[model samples]
Target: MSDLNPRETVQDALYRAARDLEARGVGYAMRDARRLMTHALGIASDRLTLFLREPLPAEAAGVFTAFCERRAAREPVSRIVEGRLFFGRWFKVTPEVLDPRPETEVLIDQALRFQFGSFLDIGTGSGCIAVTLLAERARANAFVTDISERALKIAEENALAHSVSERARFATSDWFSDVVGQFDLIVSNPPYIRPSEMETLEPEVLKGDPHIALTDFVDGLTGYRQIAAHAEKHLVPGGRVLVEIGPDEAQEVVQLFTDAGLTNCTVYQDFDRRDRVVEAFSTKPSKIG
Candidate 1:
């Protein structure tokens, strides 16, 4: 008993999946169906249209059906694909780690503006930030940390996948607890969503992303405070810190940096014009060895 229609063409299957998604209230139903079809066919997205009139392979149809089921259950596309394209590179995604978002690219851009030979990424999650930085700046190295060992494992895997493993070190620690030495830059896209707001998040995010990677269980400022508390001591003279923040968290994060003795605090906006990254510099003089 074949579950897939033997006479169904690829385009027909895609339309059927899209309609199912729409009927289930999935946003961007057609778009997602197209993407999943490409994945199932193992073809480039642009080539999908060429194969539309061809019969859908039984294996591919089964895979597409499973993907649609997951999507209908509110799993993110990234999760369904088990990876995400971040800063033009693919990083693995899983329930144990936070899915990298486009807004975090603002933090990457801000960090790149500084000529840093080394940096530290707190709460590195999947190591998208640290790995991308190391990849972009071939001469740079990084220390990556995460509170969850499982998340750290994924981060290390991403570092390896990007060929940045040699330039990146991993640690399992909350914030800066296990971090060692100072660096020219510090970056993080920490958990900043408030507990109260967690329930209001989209099902794809609320159900797919790790809770520890999304909220602080308190005021959502806990990660920032933890980072601020030890940032100066771990920063080189005039070193910079760049952190991705919630759209409304710019002022509070700036104050945290200011109070921690960092100077030149500046807020950078994302493509959407929402406050997305906060950068600051340590004013301490170079340490004499």
Candidate 2:
């Protein structure tokens, strides 16, 4: 950056980056700037404070500048970097997979509250839910499906990374079309952001994320509709379905579950107290009967 030089101390470098990001309207500018600088420096974030007064090596400074430019250009901090932490673990992220949000962890929490054996994760981007669940349950088996092959690959890598690959199965399926057997637990964080809603989302948040993973291209409910219509066929008797819901979507998603004959539908909120997860149990037997 014209405003920063290699001879600058790490402290000054961070200051300049944070100021630049803040000037560009990043709400968490200081935090992101520090993280980016640390990433570029190849140093632990916790170590930054220890080395604040140290001058940046020319190579490190240039790398930091490039990363700063990417951030300034509206690239998501997660995507610009390597991976994101979810459920206490790091999952590799890419444009092919939707960046895992803290909100989706609500789905994991809700799913874990119930007992299950065979689990199915629809649109299992990054395999965070399935892999994490299998790791937690230890005895559970997972069958994960994603429409995007690239997304499935990343999920598989995540499963392997989490050491749950032995119990996890990956496939390319649209909704439940290719799912054969029933599962005691079915979960999804389906695309619910309506096309109309996209314009309202920050461009940087959407960058490097697949468009199909963001919107149904119809009403945002298309994916939910497919899930509602097909979930009954794949859920075993007494099985549970947990899907992460967008804000203001709990009522509609609950109705869809009820319409599909999944009973005891309930919406659960995240730590932010916003409706984030929807849970429904199968009182009726799997249609596979």
Candidate 3:
């Protein structure tokens, strides 16, 4: 570890923290170290690099050590830092929600390409998707729903922070149970990870992320089933549904959408070239009960 002398410069502290994290095998060690230092010192990351020779305050050193210990234990950096940047905005995150992932940005891109007056986000953890959409498309009306009240609160806060609260609404719904109106675009990054595979996820996710937001009890496709089954009713004719799915699940999920009467379904890949988001449109309205 770099010398922890109270008189060491801020840059030195960051370097020491980064080295410590790297030795501990933490992913994104350098980035996490910089973030932790910035949080503890109340200095911008860019500035931290320039002040390497500057000594950190004694109290800041203590807080930085605590932050490093948490990160060393595999706690998500977002959780450790209390905020995560997504789609050019910072979102507050806690144990109540899943840390937003870059792969989900694919969903945003897909949404932007489509012509939709209104959007609905199912399982809107942290409201990242809904908030980003509203920020990007100012005229688009959006609603975000999550089964967990805590998650919904975070999403609401995010909406307000991003200045999109008026354009977006929050509701506590289990899928579409309480949603009343039809939307032209319905998007979700639901709990698609299979119960059986939960054990195989990274420690940061399996142990640190919210369990309810990361799983579907039956074969990991339950959320897709509910969304596909109910989407036609909640979506206007020709309205589309876009969802992020696990790799190798695209084919199965596509079939589920087809069986549910959604037509012209297609799977899109994320940056890693893995099958990721699925998009489908309702072709004909099913007979209402």
Candidate 4:
């Protein structure tokens, strides 16, 4: 990085960082540069614009330079900053857990539509889903399970940070193997990328995210299969199951839920209008043979 000019303004630094990122083919370069600047300066994103004309502080300039370099290398801004904003709240993010995403908030909206005192979040990476639910619905509690102990720890920390730890229980479980009892609702944003599709993901995802949280290795349906096989048994009568899915997987996932005797299976789309979440109800056992 070029030495920061003592007289350089925040706007000047931002423009330089954005230009560097753009030259490296990063999409939304200015937006990303601005977010990084806010993070580096420890300022609220909304407050950043007000400081744009002020001289860039030496320390913050150094941090911004490092962040821009990481972005140029195809690192996601979330990974660079080690946090993500989801459902209007900030969650700590690391390579250990899947980065919390805006699309997952679609699942959150679908979930809150139903009345549930408790919910079970399977494959609770980063605890965003469970913690957000508890925070949104004051009386709701949750049991969140993850196969990775490290991921569980991250989730636990999020729950604590959100002041929902007392209302949330954590478990290291493969699907429902270690889970006990039923919940008023069940949810998961499981690894759905097929192995064949893994190579096509953005470099930021492939290089910065843990592969275990991105793909099922064999087929993307593995997690859905496990959920279908056991979800009905883990849901209370009239309870609902909501899981985010690859846009193309809606039909197959709905079929799996139907075959499991989970009725009222329906697909909900994200802001992009892509099929993103499959919701089903556990009213009674009546599978189509």
Candidate 5:
């Protein structure tokens, strides 16, 4: 069914992969096709154009076809590639952890605005949040928690990859149950999707992501409530919390933060101007403040 010949040029092979993906309605088919092709060929993406006329090695072409088949079946390219770019750095990804999302980078942006001696990340899937913080704020150490030990291990691997392993500690716990430190900045991109909403996510998303990382399987407010209730107790005075949230859940979540005694609550929008992050100051003002 492919237009590829027995000895097709790299471009022809790549084009055929894209065409096949497009036919299957794979969103971002062309881009993913190129990624799959380059990764399969073990070549740099920028080198793709240069190899257009070169015949793809038979082995590489076969690998490309397999990757294309997986893509057509709707596996996320990031998951298939086992890595994703978050906060401008690549973090290893796996089915055990959540594939880091670009929108969640807002947590990094907002947290960087304040100075913190220590950081806490709840549900630190893949360690993207915790490791990136430690990498950026060289002076800060982090305590990251996850309910899934498997996910915590993935986060630990990513922390090592980002060279933040020395500054990060990963724990398996339900929320803050076993967390031991007080932190100046507590952040999370928790499971905020509601149960019913889970069924509506894109097929690729549902397939490539861990269900535990995707939804609370509740009204989506469960994580918010627990974080709000416990985060304040674990924060250093005047500490701040910046949480990624469902766009429409801002008002309720803000109230939960307020109820937990976090002050100066503010909701921030993503680049698209949808409410994406909520920030609040702990009730006890620090001497440093």
Candidate 6:
């Protein structure tokens, strides 16, 4: 309402919003402002530069300012935009699910490196992992499970949006409780943050994200332990399990897999050189007593 169209162009509004966001200590302020302006005004950021003398409608300016406020309060851009791009596909995201981070792509890359016919994504959240696998390997069968019904719904919508719904299945379960049969590949990006460390995470993560999907009540390895313990049963012989873990959790997770009798346990680093993923495979078929 502050004369957002005072002979200034959309580019001027963007720069002002970026300055406001920067003043509030929002990371990626310039980038987020540009994206918000593009989304609200329906114009590309590059195009805005060419129309610097064009004025933004009052309504558009109002919406853009509100977006800047939310972002300044540490709300994730994904939540504000209601979607994010993962593996070159747009995925619907919400407060109910953790925003899909680039680090998780390491899991997908690892999965594609192996020969597998079927895959399971435990704690699927927005179904980014499952849908990506299905879309990339058209013949692959994939299933995703989430404890939160709301999260599952978002995942389903994403699967359908990405045109992988037919090849993807959604279920509500606490880990593998309702999963049936064995899969050749099982992957997860489960809650791996320790309770004590949760307080230290960025405000956008600590306040805006769902805590249940970010941390486990115990030592932060609870999900990994459960997955490793039961993976041998839910996975075909020689089937591998891939998981994204906290940077400090790599060694502990590798030990858990080893203790569960999974062989060839290994950890991979992400772009930031953090130990970000763990991979292991079942040694032999074992009957559950």
- The C-alpha lDDT values of all candidates are 0.89, 0.86, 0.88, 0.91, 0.87, 0.87
lDDT (Cα, tens digit) per residue for candidate 6, span 1-289 = 2336555678788888888888889888889988888767866546766655678877887788788888888888888888888998889999999899999999889989967789999999988899999999989988889999999999999989988898877899998889887789999999999889987999988876899999986789989988987899988888899999999998899999999899999899999999999999897875553
Q: Write the per-residue lDDT of candidate 2 for residues 58-137, one digit (tens) a residue.
A: 88888888888888888888888868889999899988888888988888877777778899899988888888899889
lDDT of 2: 0.86
Clashing pairs in 1: none
lDDT of 3 by residue, 1-289 (tens): 4337787777777777888888888878888888898888887766876656667889989898899888988888889888898998899998999999999999999989977789899999999999999999889999789999999999999999989999887899998888878889999999988888988898999767898888877788989999988999888889999999999899999999999999899889999999999999987864444
> How many times do residue backbones clash in model 4?
0
Models 1 onward score TM values of 0.96, 0.95, 0.95, 0.97, 0.95, 0.95
* Better model by lDDT: candidate 4 vs candidate 5: 4
Residue pairs with clashing backbones, model 2: none
Model 3 segments more than 4 A misplaced: 1-3, 285-289
True-structure lDDT of candidate 5: 0.87
Question: For model 1, what is the error of residue 27's alpha carbon versus the real structure, in angstroms, after optimal superposition?
Answer: 0.4
Q: Which residue pairs in candidate 4 collide?
A: none
RMSD of each predicted structure: 1.9, 1.5, 1.8, 2.4, 2.2, 1.9
Tens-digit lDDT track for model 1 on 1-289?
Answer: 1255868999999888898898998999999999888999999888998999999998999999999998988899999988888999989998899999998888888887768999999999988999999999999989999889999999999988888899888889877778889999999888899998998999999888999889889988998998788888888988998888999999999999899889999999999999999989999765434
Which 10 consecutive positions of candidate 4 have the poorest summed lDDT?
280-289
**What's the ranking of the predictions by lDDT, best on top?**
4, 1, 3, 5, 6, 2
Best by TM-score: 4
Model 4 has an lDDT value of 0.91
Give the winner by lDDT.
4
**Predicted structure 1, TM vs. truth:** 0.96
